[model samples]
Target: MKTKSLLLAALFAALTAIGGFIKIPIPYVPFTLQIAAVYLAGCLLGPKLGMLSQLVYVLVGLAGAPVFAEGGGPSYVLQPTFGYLIGFAAGAYVNGWLMQIFQFRKAATVFLANLSALFAVYLFGCSWLYIAMKWIVEKPLTIGQTLWFGFLLPVPGDLLLCAVCSILVARMLPRIHSVIRKQEVVS
Candidate 1:
């Protein structure tokens, strides 16, 4: 990878970690700006690097950096919310992949890509929450309860953030690409 790409990936990883600390505390899952950061990473960095950034964030948290929402360590994997951390990588990849397919020039396309990526995040997170609650944590929540806590509760805030991110990305992409092009030429 180019030096710029690596730096940007690292920057995003740091942003994600920072985002974990900025959250509105709630019962099961606190709302965080992490999703917004994830969306921006994918929209700006493209699929592979975006995914790499999120992966680095997760790995760093797992290595006990205290970078996660509720602290960090290998033991965090046992936490019900850890699945959302995993989803960050997957969602970034999916977001960038879709943007590549539909092109990121239009607001609608960017919004659509982000919304789809949101689904991926929720799918992984909700599924993991259900599994962790039922078995690992031995909480044994019903499906309805799991869905309510894991999906329904947090989604409205996420959706609003997604809309804002999509607009930001759409507006910024052209300038970002031009800069990248200039950098490549300079190299």
Candidate 2:
């Protein structure tokens, strides 16, 4: 891997970890700016690197970095919200892939890409929440309650963050790509 790419991935992972600190605690899942950071990673780094960045974040947290909204460590995987953490990586990958297909220049395309990524996160999160809550946590919840508690409650804020991230991605992509191209030529 190029040094610059690796550095960018590390920087994004760090940003995500930092973002976890800015949290709004709720019942099942806490709202956090980490999703915005995840979006930024995808929009800035592309799919492969973006996913790598999220993986780095997860590994660091698993190593007891205390980088999650709550605490960290392998035990975190048991948490109902852990699915969201896993979703972050998938969401970033989907965001980057959609950006490649749709192109980020158009505002509508950027918005759609971000929205799609958000849905990917929700899908993984809600599914994991349902399974974990029912089997592991032994707190069985109906589908409606699961959707309400796990997904709907925080969606509005996520949508707002998506808008903000889409705008930022649209604005920054050209410059970021230009830099990468220049680096490639130099190399």
Candidate 3:
């Protein structure tokens, strides 16, 4: 990877951490702008770098940085919300991969890509929530309850954020691509 790409990845990792700090506390999942940052990182950086950015954020948190919505550490894996953190990296990779394949120029395509990415996030997040609650935390919630808490409740806000991100990406992506091209040439 280019130095510029590495720098951008680090920048997005910081942004994701910042997003975790700015959150509205709720029952199980706190609503945060981390998802938006993740999406933007994917849209701007493409697949490998986008995934690298989120992985950096996750690793930093695991290394005992308080960069997560709750606190952070190795033990954070036991938390119900930890799955969502993993989902961030997965979602970014999916979004970046889709964008690369589709060459998302239209707003609709961008929005679709965002939605697909969102699905990946929910898949990991909801699954983790279910497993953590049932086995790790020993709460044993029903699937319906897990879906309600993990998916349904936070999804509306997440959808709105994704929509906004899609619009932003649609407008800004061309410029970002050109800048990246220039960076590659200079490198």
**Which numbered prediction scores highest in lDDT against the true structure?**
3
Error of 3 at 85 (Å): 0.9
Q: Flag the better candidate by lDDT, 1 or 3.
A: 3
Model 2: lDDT equals 0.88
Candidate 3, residue 71: how far the Cα is off, in Å: 0.8
What's the lDDT for all of these models? 0.90, 0.88, 0.91
Each prediction's TM-score against the native? 0.96, 0.94, 0.95
Model 3, residue 172: distance off in Å is: 0.6
Task: State the lDDT of candidate 3 residue by residue for 1-187, as single tens digits.
Answer: 7897889999999999999999887779999989998889888788889999999999999999999999999999999999999999999999999999989977778888888878989999999999999999898889999999899999988999999999999999788779879999999
For all candidates, what are the clash counts? 0, 0, 0
Higher-ranked by lDDT: 1 or 2: 1
Give lDDT tens digits, candidate 1, residues 1-187: 8997899999999999998999988778899989998999888888999999999999999999999999999999999999899899999999999888778677778988888778988989989999999899998778899889988988999999999999999899889889989999999
Candidate 1: lDDT over CA atoms?
0.90
Query: Which residue ranges in model 3 land beyond 4 Å of their true spot?
Result: 180-187
Clashing pairs in 1: none
User: Highest TM-score: which candidate?
Assistant: 1
